[model samples]
Target: MEDAAMEDGETNKDSEVAPALIAVHPTQNSVAVAVGSDLRVFDLLGGCAVSLVNDSDGSLHKDSIRAIRYGANGKLSVSAGDDKLVKIWSTKSWRCISSVEVIESLLTLLAVKR
Candidate 1:
């Protein structure tokens, strides 16, 4: 989940800010989570919350990640953030496959494969 400060008139309110928590897809073998400024993908079936992927290279997003969802093929996962960008990663290799800018602060992203 992503955390953002609410703009209150002229000042930004930080005290009332709340971080977002993203849930993984129920049928996916992996789970994606955004904690603080890092994006982590976990191996759900392994019992231990093992880290399978990480996006902390400063190129992904400066702020927290807002949303994460598995693609229709179950082999890809998409993530969007306040950075106004959407990134798609492969579940098998846990590598970035594509990225697109939507020009708006993306609240969520869903990838469908035909």
Candidate 2:
């Protein structure tokens, strides 16, 4: 399958690639996307407008994002991928807060609170 992946060490660019997976923020009405080796988010506050993320550095992920999910009533978003890492981001800034490495391929994931 063809995937539109950005060049190495590259961050945001035109989304020419088809997304591998998608998750909706339950209360935020936003969407999280797993596109190629990147994870992008679109905040639907008004229309379908979106902006590039991880603009500060090309540190979003090293491989294609495999899964994404929202939890805590849309306050937090989680993403995982072939990189064997699960990243958690805050909804307020869309900034990554933590990273946890695993030993398995992250083909699917979920984030929830008890």
**Per-residue lDDT of candidate 1, residues 46-91 (tens digit):** 8555434445443655656777777666777777777667878777
- Model 2: runs farther than 4 Å from truth? 1-19, 48-58
**Best candidate (score: TM-score):** 2
TM-score of each: 0.66, 0.69
Candidate 2 vs. true structure, TM-score: 0.69
Top candidate, metric lDDT: 2
Model 1 TM-score relative to the real fold: 0.66
> What is the Cα-based lDDT of residue 1 in candidate 2?
19
